[model samples]
Every structure is written in structure tokens, then in C-alpha cells.
Target chain A: MLDNSMKLEFPSKSQNESFARVVVASFAAQLDPTIEELADVKTAVSEAVTNSIIHGYENSLGIVYIECEIKNNKLEIIIEDKGKGIENVNEAMEPLYTSKPELERSGMGFTVMETFMDHLEVYSEEGRGTKIKMVKEFKSVSIKE
Target chain B: MQLHFNVKDENLIVRFTGELDHHTAQEIRNKIDNKYKNDMLKNIILDLKGINFMDSSGIGLIMGRYKTTRANDGSLVLINVNSRMEKILTMSGILKIVKVYRNEDEALHNI
Candidate 1:
């Protein structure tokens, strides 16, 4: 019973990360989420989009697909990238483990997404692509002020 | 994002406005590093009052600055950290290394 849904395709560029966050946050705004909740969603979305750009595409040009759906108080977000896929997801998900450490990455992207979202699922095949599906259920809807 | 720098004694106070994320982290890092190199500042005080949003990249930025300050035998402190950002810092194990204060006055007094 989805109230509304959106799918966006943007270049795998660092600048587009902010654009992805804005789109997801704005779409989730209909849930009447609090400022903190909205920030959480924005941060999670930013991490996912950044991972796709930095890890998936590795600076090469590609397309990052983002799909967002809202059903009741629950929001589902899916970010996909068709580029170099993860060889070992478990290692990639480890804290402080980044393939591009020279880039000064903290390697906490997936951890932050997991912490902020209610549920997170990662699916990838080497040389294929990676798709991250995250869900967040708002505790209580706020009335328009 | 907008960054304001104020030097007091040997301390450098950086006030950040707007979101801090991967997109803006590199520019912010370069700016701070350049300022640190050219100025005689010993300590850094990051003012987070104007920052409404920050992701894990923010943590990396703080950590990198902390290392640079320590290398120069100086310290890095944080001020005006909202609860949301504080939570992220705490989770990332940054609070254990960096000191946090309520305002610039307190940070300046201590640093």
C-alpha cells in the first residue's frame, strides 16, 4: 500500500550526493518526521550515495539509481550502482575497513546507514553491481505546523 | 557550506555553516590545512552551532584535523555540538579522543 514512490537516476559524481540526499529527505517529509528523523534519513542516504560513487564507480562515469517508496509511516529506499561490485561484503561492512583508505575515507558509511535505518540489506555480485535497500519506520507522525 | 575562521591567541576557531558531508569534506579539509600551515595557530576549536547536518565524513574531517594538531603538539576541541551530531561523534569513537565544550568561551578558556 504505497502512498507514493520516486525513482531518480543521477551521475556517479560526488556533487550528486547532496542532490540524492535532498530528494530522499524531501520525499520522506510527507511522513511529517521530526528534524532529527529527517536528518537521520538524509545522512543515511548520503552515505549510500557516496559509497556508490566512491566504491562502486571508483570515479568513473556511471549512473546511480535511487528508488524511494513510502507506505504508511514506513519509508523504503533502494540505491543501486552498476559498477565494480564488492568482493567481500562482510569485510566491506567492517568498521574502519576501506578499500580506498588513501582517500581518507573513514569506512563507516555502511555502519552509519545501518545505525540510522531500521533495516538494511546489501546485495552484490562481483563485476555486476551492488544494491542497498534500507527501511526506516517513523515512530510518530508530526502535525503540520 | 560556509566556514568562518577566527584566531585567538594560538587557537584557531572554525565555525561551519550548513551541511558537512563527503561532497564538502575535501574542500573544508584543504582550507583548514592551508590555514594551519600559513598561520601560527596551535589549537583548533570547531564551532558546530551553525551546522545542521553532518555525516560520517564529518567525523573523518575532525579526526584528520586532530591528527594534524597533535602532530604539531597542539589540541583540537569542539564547541556547540548539537545532540544529533554529538550522537554520531560518540558512535564513531571520536568523543573519546577529542574534547567538547559548550561554547567558544569555554573552549578558548580550556585550550
Candidate 2:
């Protein structure tokens, strides 16, 4: 359906992790992505939202904002949280480097997003908040040779 | 998520259904851990055939369970992991430490 955009704001509860992923996946379906592509988007969205709930907000009640846009065959998602921002974006993105290891976090959130999506960018301030911008290109909707 | 547990000897075989994510991981972990302690199970056999979706949180759950099993001198193995889930597990490098089986029998034999 051409290009479209949507925004969602929800409480930073663990339960909304699934909700965020499903909403993004449903919107991404307009791109006619394959099962695997859909799964990739869903996984990436889940990772971002989970990070907002557990790390950004520190598991306390907060707000998680998600913006999704489908442009041609490309889908861009921005997940932001007005919570405790990340101190080090690079270190946080490193695989297996979880600040909350006691919570059993695998620390693969950013890694998963980088692997599944075409582009990923992180913007954060020490005490402001964290924002994740990710873009994924769908091969299924690309022009054929 | 729903967990079906079967205890045989010192092994706890759990078949997980539904999505495994941050929302459901705690409940699933608690239930399995409780059963493992109450039944004194030494090993954990995770059957993931019924899992429709999973993310990195699934990896954390597995790794946590693996740690728990190891602490008790036991083991953890996975079975019926679809290619989709296998990709995530492989990306996380968990496959290097955990073993995967074709079915419950194979996991049972190996564990």
C-alpha cells in the first residue's frame, strides 16, 4: 500500500515487548516480505523494545515510543524511551556484554538488530533517553532484473 | 507460553509452546526451575517444536538453564529447533556450548 507511517506509545512493561513486535510485523507485512524477513523484523523489534523496558527504564514504569514507516520495499523503525539513557552505546551494542547480567540478559539485543536489519543507529544522552533507528530492506518487494 | 514437563529419573523434559521473549521467559524459567528443584532433575531436555516465535531472550533462557544444570553437575540439550530458531542460536554462538538433537530419544541418549 505505497508508503505509510504509524506511531505507538506504550508503557515500558515487559508484556508490551511482544505487542510491539507483533504491531511492527503486521505493518511490515504490507511489504510482502517472506516468512524469514518477517521473522527478522519481529526479532529486531522485540530486542529493541525489551532493551527499553529492562535497561532504558531499568524495569520501572516508563514510556516506550515506536515509530514505523514503510517506504517502498524498505521499512524503518524508531524505538525510543524516555528513561535512563545508555552510558556507552558502543559497549552496549557489543555481543555478550550485558549490564544486567543478573537478569540473565544475553546482551545480543543490538547485535541482533544489526544482523537482521540493513541499518541501525543509536542516539542517547546520559540522563535524557535512548533512541534506536533501524531500517530493513525487503528483497521480496524489490524490482526484478 | 506453556510448558509441559515430564520427569524421568533425574531428567526434566520440557516442551515449550508459544513465543519465548522477555515477557514470557520469566514465567517459563520459574516454572521449569521449580520443577527441576522439586524433582531433583539433573538434566534438561528442551523440546522446541511447538515454539512459533523466539528472540534473543530465548537464548538467555537457554543459557540460564544451562548454567543452572551445570551448577548441579547436570546438562542441557535442545531438540526440534527449526532452522529459523537455529539461526538465532547459531548467531548467539550458543550452539557451540549446547548440543542439539533430532528428537527426544536422541537428546535422551546423548544427555
Give the DockQ (2 decimals) of all models. Answer: 0.76, 0.88
Summarize candidate 1's per-residue lDDT along A86-145 as a digit string, tens digits: 999999999877897666788889889999999999999999999999999998775443
TM (chain A) per model:
0.95, 0.96
Return the clash pairs for model 2, or none: none
DockQ of 2: 0.88
- Give residue B59's lDDT in candidate 2 (0 to 100): 93
Residue-by-residue lDDT tens digits, candidate 2, B15-101? 988999988998999999999998888999999999999999999999999999999999999999999999999999999999999
Model 1, B15: alpha-carbon shift in Å?
0.9
lDDT of 1 by residue, B9-41 (tens): 888999999889988999999999899879977
Top model number, TM-score: 2
In model 2, which runs have C-alpha deviations exceeding 4 angstroms? A142-145
> Candidates' TM-scores?
0.96, 0.97
lDDT per residue for candidate 2 within A1-145, as digits (tens), equals: 5679999999998988989999999999878899999999999999999999998889589999999988778999999999899999889989999998888899998999999999999999988899999999998785633
